[model samples]
Target chain A: MRDTYQEQLDELASGLADMCDDVARAMARATTALLEADLQLAEQVISEDIKIDDVRAAAEHRAFGLLALQAPVATDLRVVVAAIHGAGDIERMGDLALHVAQAARRRHPQTVLPDEVKSYFAEMGRVGVELAEKAGRVIRTRDLDAANELEADDDAVDDIHQHMFTVLMDRNWTHGVSAAVDVALLARFYERYADHAVAVARRIVYVVTGQMPGPLAV
Target chain B: MRDTYQEQLDELASGLADMCDDVARAMARATTALLEADLQLAEQVISEDIKIDDVRAAAEHRAFGLLALQAPVATDLRVVVAAIHGAGDIERMGDLALHVAQAARRRHPQTVLPDEVKSYFAEMGRVGVELAEKAGRVIRTRDLDAANELEADDDAVDDIHQHMFTVLMDRNWTHGVSAAVDVALLARFYERYADHAVAVARRIVYVVTGQMPGPLAV
Candidate 1:
């Protein structure tokens, strides 16, 4: 019976890891939709919302079942809680990707942007995607260092966010108000994506430190 | 020893409850500042950001502590977890208040709509404030019906949000590009305020139902 219980726990963790992989991949696909202007991909993300939601529910049920039967103590309990929070955060990130896809539908075809702005978004998207990947890695390995690294990346994201705001406001550009709005929201989506990555990092800290460490500003 | 432990738990609950009260009031005050263009109130909301941050940290710590030591089983465990989730949502709501207040600084001394708009705003504000107030009541009373009521009230907020958007987009309005930005963002603040209230309501449902509920329509 004890061996069976141990195997069950292992299975639960494996299942959770798989679900995180799917979430990370789903997010990457949504961003792909944005950059490629692919309606099929947007529809894919929208449909996958329920799938992510299902994984979250399954993970929670597994966690609760383990706790109910085995009565997980201390760090194990925290692990369950951390997984729950991480699950919820990633689901929200998925929703953001869907929002970006929806907004992209309204945007002018062919990613027309001033060269600098285009580069800014490319860099931001690259980092945001990297952070999502890193979050999945941290979940799999519980690598404290990888999570900490994501914290430093948020600063770069914030710098881009601030710069984009300046471009939106500067009178010299005569940036169309609608274009400004779209870019502003997109920049914001990236920055917020970065911030949520930081949050995942902080959540990892909570697991390691047994308390939530300070915000990822450091 | 039992008394001391219980006291600690009670104190933590009250501190969290206080944060809830602060957030609800801050949201109501933001609407007042927007309508009245009261810069002083706006400044107050902005300044309170750090204090709100402090409240959130304190609340999360207390919740974590309760979890770590008590290992609260079943529904009690759900309540503390719900508190953490609700606290995070309300904190964002408080941040949205600042957004509204900041937007107010850019608006004209008075809104240009006919007298009917103000009446609409008044009714909308009342519903929003009531919905938010009920979030706290759900916390204290653990009343699922009140939680459902709050979710229902959010529909009225959505109604007002749509109306405001229509007014802003109307060709007859003399509002310029900047005003349009303020209107869009202000509407966002209200929509998000209502969103947080619905989130709290959802949490309340989970606390009572022992299963997370479906998303409430805006």
Candidate 2:
């Protein structure tokens, strides 16, 4: 039977995985809100971000209690510390999704993306959700191979982000500067969301392997 | 006489302060690089960012060691935990500065900012530096009043960020879509730099008072 200390550690891991799932759902809905110009869905994402924050606060409190009470060492210590950092990254992922939703609401009744770039955003959204869900799986299973996969998934998001700039800068582009600015910021939101998911995956790798794969590209 | 554990805690606090100063310097130089179109200065900021990262790594190592060896509780545990979080926030501030520098480098031989918005960016740089310096002070001194001041300073950056969008969308904007995108992203880098500075301050407040001042506005 697992001791209470081990149980608490297991709970922390599951809690972080659950937070990743929450943000994944948030990103999926946020993407729909962006693509469909669905004001109601956007508002739902904007309001529900607090639930992610609540999970983060609870994870931090639980980690703190474990650290103070158990004084966990070695891998256990790394797990608790990684939980604290992972919670922060996942919370930021939620914030990035919220930003995407807010961008959608800001342009409601007037789609933020031009017809030309909608497909690009749709692809980014799909990849972003995949990244978030994979990050959760990485955290739950401690599968280093899965954690490493997030880097490639993040590269896919970065490629889309780069392609977006090319579209914005093309001479054939017809969207005004305002729309261009909105698209640029929105692309960034997606990119950062993927980056945070990758960050969470990296933290889990550290917890299991005692080594960070590498510094994030920044 | 202070035991080695107490000395380690003090060293961790001062190390975080030093990191805040490092990022502050990076931001100031990055702003100069942005405003003057100094390719050399921009390159300098980009390369020197690793030094900030080094400090962050060291701080994290020290904190982890303290947590494992000392098993601190209550305020000491909070202090060590806050140092880890603070280090991350300050390192992100450094990354934001590097992004600003990269923006400048990307537009080398051509100033990134048009004349109309130069003054606004200059002001942001100035205020951003002030916020970083104040955050360092807050970490070192645990001054709650000083920590509260960061919110107003961040507001100043936000106001400038909002105003820059208005300028970009103005009927008079003649810089075209590319320039508008550059300026939008630059403004966000500055605004986020200020936000991280505030995040560091809030973490310091939590260390001292055992209460987070509030959630940072996403």
Candidate 3:
């Protein structure tokens, strides 16, 4: 029974890693769709979000089942609980990715990003994908070193977010109100996506250290 | 022993309700701070968010305890799990409220919203508080009817959100990109706060009816 319980916990961790992999792909594709104006890719990313949800639901089911049947205590209990909460954060990261895809789809045939901030978004997208991939690694390995790196990764996203604002607020910015709104919203989506990724990493760190990480700086 | 378990479950529910109450108050105060540009009120809301976090941590601890000790099954298991997840959503709602407060505080003596959309934000503030209060009732009563009402309540928030966008997109909007960015971000904060409240209600409805609601229309 103890061996079976340990196996189930391993499965829960793997399921979360798989969900993170899916989310990472979605973020990558969503950014590509945004930059290249690929509506098909955007739609694909949006539709596949359901798969991430399914993975999360399964993880929650397994964790709850373990709680009900095994009644894991101490470290085991913490792992199961963190699995449930970490799955939630991952699921939300998927939602944020979908938002990015939808924004790309809604602005189809026209680039959602104004030309001025195009390169900035490209850099943001790169860092966003890197963060999601790193998040997957942290969940799979629970390496405190890798988990701690997410903060710096998210800080890069924030810097770009701040830069996006600076560009919008610049006197040279000629984009109309509509484009400005689009740009602002897009930057926010990316920034928030990074935040959720960091939150997931922090949850893993908490499970390892038993020191509760405070809320992400939203 | 069964009676003791039942009492623990009751405590979990009460703790969650108390957390909801604190979050509701934070949202209300954050909105007032924004509307009045009351830095003190904003700062108070910002600081009080930590208290909400503490409430959530305690609630999670209680729920985890029940899960480990009593090994609740069936409906009991579902309720405990929901408490954990629901507390998370409520805590996030508090974070969103904190974001609102931070926006107001950052703007300091200068008002964040442009003059044209002032009344619109006022309406949003009123609706935000009403939604949070109603959310508390839905959680406390577990009334499917009350829970279902949150979707329509969120619709009201979405309407204001759309109106804000329309105003921003209007050619008549003379506010520079800075004010426009501020307004866009503020609108998003309220919109997401409403979405989280609706999500909490949906979780209750799920526990009651077992019908899963799809993602929020972000």
Give the CAPRI rating of model 1: acceptable
Q: Candidate 2: list runs displaced more than 4 Å.
A: A1-3, B1-3
lDDT of 3 by residue, A1-218 (tens): 35577898888888888888888899899999998899999999999998888888889889978987888887788888888888888888888889889988998899898776888888888888888888889988889999888899899999999888788878888877778888888998889888888888888888888877777546
Output DockQ, candidate 2: 0.86
| Cα RMSD, each candidate | 3.8, 1.6, 2.3
DockQ metric for all predictions: 0.30, 0.86, 0.66
lDDT of 2 by residue, B40-135 (tens): 999999999999988998999999999999999999999999998888889999999999999999989899999989999999999999999999
Per-residue lDDT for A31-107 in model 2, tens only? 99999999999999999999999999999999999989999999999999999999999999999999999999998
Assess the local accuracy of residue B11 in candidate 3 as a C-alpha lDDT between 0 and 100: 82
| Best candidate according to DockQ | 2
Query: In lDDT terms, how accurate is model 1?
Result: 0.69
Ranking by TM-score: 2, 3, 1
Error of 1 at A29 (Å): 2.9
For every model shown, the clashing-pair count is: 0, 0, 0
Off by over 4 Å in 3: A1-3, B1-3, B214-218
Candidate 3 backbone collisions, by pair: none
User: Lowest lDDT 10-mer window, candidate 3 chain A?
Assistant: A209-218
Q: Which candidate's TM-score is highest?
A: 2
Candidate 3's fnat?
Answer: 0.73
